[model samples]
Target: MHATLTAPSARRTRDRATLVCGIAGLASCMIVIMADFTTATIYERLGLFADTISAMAAGRGAMIMDTALLILVGGIVAIAFGLWRQRLPGWRWRAVIIALLAVAGIIAAIALFNEYGDGDVNDSWTFHYRLVYALGIIFTAVPLLAAHDLKPIDRRLWLGSYALGAAWFVAGPLMFTVPTGWDGLLERVAAGIMLLWLIGASIFLIRQPDGR
Candidate 1:
């Protein structure tokens, strides 16, 4: 009887953890949006549509944006751990978890080594731009890898992930081709796609029947 009781208790604990992580994932999305807009207001020359988030972190509101990014890292890490506890089958699922952690690390690095201000050009020596490039690759890879695994859990999420990945493949390259003033807009669109997947995946994890 004690063993059986412990099993249910453990399951409940996992459920609660997944639930908290899901909420954290959602909260992280809100924090980034708020930080971007708040910091944009601090700079007279900053144009939200024309200025990339890196510009916000590199300029007048560096402290605010950097601090928010650190907080965002914690939230993403939580979501990664939440998924890790699920013990999903196959290498694809494992790859998804690894990608999520990599993304969190990249975000933290970006905050640490922010890019040049909006008007400045970043050379090859800048690790910030290199990290951004790496992030774009791995971030998009997560949804594509996880899409197959998510099929058994939720068909809609699986389809959404596949579609999101496909869209990123096209849009990611377009970001660089866009005019100077438009790159920022495209950057945000790319980020929004990733965040949407993160939010949706977290919700599905929270709703899992067994909370595994």
Candidate 2:
């Protein structure tokens, strides 16, 4: 009887943790979206279509963007641990956790190194561009990696993950093909798709009592 009671108690504890992490994930995305929007609007000369997000991070109000990145890192870390507690079969859980943690590390680095400071202090700019590209691929893969597991939990989310991947491919790789000045627009398109997947995935975990 004690063992039986313990099992349910532990499960409930985990469920609460998963729920909190899911909420963290959602909150992080919302915060970053607001920061991006606010910062983008602040610089009137910086064309939203022509200037990259990195450009927004470079000059004034960069602190806001950097702070958002750090918050995102925290959110990703929570999601990684939360997913690890779920019952994903085979290597699905491991893959998802690795991807989430990797993203968290990358974003943390971006936030710490920052785009301010003169003349590439600590060579942050060099690391920045490469990591940005790496982020596009790895983040896009998150939905693809977890789609199989998500199918059973939520069909709409499962289908949406693949759809998000397809959009990411177009926005990421094909951005270069769509005229030079429009790259930023394409980048934002990819980012929006990513945000959708994050929110969907977070909701999936939040709604599941056992974090299925």
Considering every candidate listed, which one attains the maximal TM-score?
Answer: 1
Which pairs clash in model 1? none
RMSD of each: 2.6, 2.5
For candidate 2, lDDT tens digit of each residue in 8-44?
Answer: 8998888898899889988998998888888878863
Name the TM-score of candidate 2.
Answer: 0.88
Q: Which residue window of length 10 is worst by lDDT in model 2? A: 115-124
lDDT of 1 by residue, 160-191 (tens): 99999988888877887889887888988887
Maximum-lDDT candidate: 1
lDDT of all predictions: 0.82, 0.78
lDDT of 1: 0.82
